[model samples]
Target: MNRAVHAVRRHAVMAVGVLVLLYLFLPVAVVVAFSFNDAAGRFNFSWQGFTLDAWRHPCRVPGMCESVSTSLQVGAIATVAATILGTLLAFALARHQFRGRASTSLLVFLPMATPEVVMGASLLTLFVNVGVATGFATIVIAHILFTVSFVVVTVKARLAGFDSRLEEAAMDLYADEWQTFRRITLPLAAPGILSGALLAFALSFDDFIITNFNSGTTITFPMFVWGAAQRGVPPEVNVVGAAMFILALGCVGGAEVWRRVRAARR
Candidate 1:
């Protein structure tokens, strides 16, 4: 009777897990399905037919392609800048002890912890005070500010396991500090940095609210989607979103594979 009870419990646990997974993924699955939907006037899971016309008809919306291009440019530049700065900050926080360290850490994380609207409002105020005109540049700055926190946290976790003695021993062997860090610390931490960068890029690319507030007269993909939705989103917008989702998944999967490969080699 005890063995039968245990078996039943195991099955129950598995069933619950399966249900949770389905709940999470079902919406995404539905969206992808709708992207290929051929129904006119209304689209849903009940497939009226199948078509790829939506994917090919993005040109129907004026400035749609330009918005996508601008988003890519901003996300790429912001991610690069944020990753470099955040990785360096992570190294300093992990390796050095300094005054106001706690305060500094809190400040660094403020952007991530704060609500998007609040962050956006604050940035907008700062730009106005500084007389900085809003557009792609403002959006890039906001993206970097928010996304840097992710990079810092990720790289800091990797740094926790790092042995400073390796650098010390390298110094003992007549290697300079920079040389030791380049040869030892950097190689070990590269995977974490790379993963953080990919994550930052994904976040920046998908951002809508903060980008909307900071971007004045500059349109990104999310902005395009929002404006289109106000007029009832066309099927092609769904197609664009589906394509982005696939690309994002590919990037994340590639990062994970790279991380695993690095671990295996180590």
Candidate 2:
């Protein structure tokens, strides 16, 4: 009786897990399926036979390419800047203990913890007060500000688990701080740093709400999608979304593979 009950429970759990996965991925599956649809209207995903029309005819959709390009540029700039600043902040937080350290940590992580609407409004207010014109540059700066928190957290977690004696040993062997950090610390922590940056890039690329608030006339992919949805999305939006999803998945997979390879080598 117990064995039968156990089997029943296991099956029940598996069924629930499958349902949850489907619930999460069903929309994405539909989007991917419809990206190849011959129809022009995005809302009509009835699959009137598969064609690469959307992928090939991206130019037919007004502002699709421009939005994509803007998203890429903004994501790239924000990711780079956030990664550098966050990594440095992580290093400082991990290596040194100082007054207001707790406050510093809270401030660093505030962006991630705060509500998105609040952060966006606050940033918009700050920009207006400072007389900063809203555009791609402002959008990029806002993305970097919000995205850096994730990087800081990821890098700091790695640093927390790191053995500090490696750096000490390097120092004992006459290596300076810069050399020790570049040669020993960074090499060991590179996986986490890279992973953090990749994660940041993905977030920045996909962001909509904050980007919309900060962006004036500059349309990122999400903004384009929003505007297009007013008139009903073009089928090409599905293509673009699917492409971005695949690219992001590949980047994350690559980072994971690299981390595992480094670990096995070590």
Candidate 3:
């Protein structure tokens, strides 16, 4: 009886987990499906039939490609800037004793806790008062401001689990600070740093609220999608969405495979 009850509980947990995953991924599945739809009109709603036209001619929609390019540029810039700054901040916070450290940590996390609407509005007001023009530069700056908090938070979590004794052992072997860091500290922290960077890029690319406020005349992909929604969104838009999803999935799969390979070798 106990064995039967245990099996039923395990099956129930698995069923719930599967349901939750399906709930999350059902929309993604639909997006991928619609990318191949032969839309009867500007609206890519109902599936008429499957066609690879959109995949073949993703740039067939004029401004769509340009907007995607802008998003990529902004995401890259923000990811680099945020990752560097956040990694440094994470190290300082985790490894040092300094004045106002508590306050500084609080400030670092404030952006994460604060609502995007509030942050966006505040940023806009600051820009207006400072007479900074709102455009691509402003968008990148805004993204960095928000994304840094996430990067720092992520890297800090990694640092918390780090074995400082590894650095000490390296030092005992007469390795210099930079050498110990280069050979030991960095390699372990690299996964966290990479994860933070990927997260920053995703946030920057997907951001619409903050970008919209700071974009002015510049259009990113999310902004383009928002504007297109007023009109009928193009099937090519779905193509872009599907392509991004596939690319992200590929990166994640590649990383996991690499991790498993490294683990097996160890």
Q: Rate the local accuracy (lDDT) of all candidates.
A: 0.88, 0.89, 0.94
Candidate topping lDDT: 3
| Estimated TM-score for each candidate | 0.88, 0.90, 0.95
Any runs in candidate 1 off by more than 4 Å, and if so which? 1-4, 41-47, 251-266
* Model 2 pairs whose backbones collide: none
Q: Per-residue lDDT for 198-261 in model 2, tens only?
A: 8898899889989988998999999998898787776788998888789878977997899999
Global lDDT for candidate 1? 0.88
Candidate 3 error regions (>4 Å)? 1-6
Best-fitting candidate, scored by TM-score: 3
| RMSD, one per candidate, in order | 2.6, 2.3, 1.6
Q: Which candidate model has the greater lDDT, 1 or 2?
A: 2
Arrange candidates, best lDDT first: 3, 2, 1
At residue 262, candidate 1 shows an lDDT of 100
Decoy 3 TM-score against native? 0.95
Residue 257 in model 3: lDDT: 100
Look at candidate 2 and tell me the lDDT of residue 262. Answer: 100
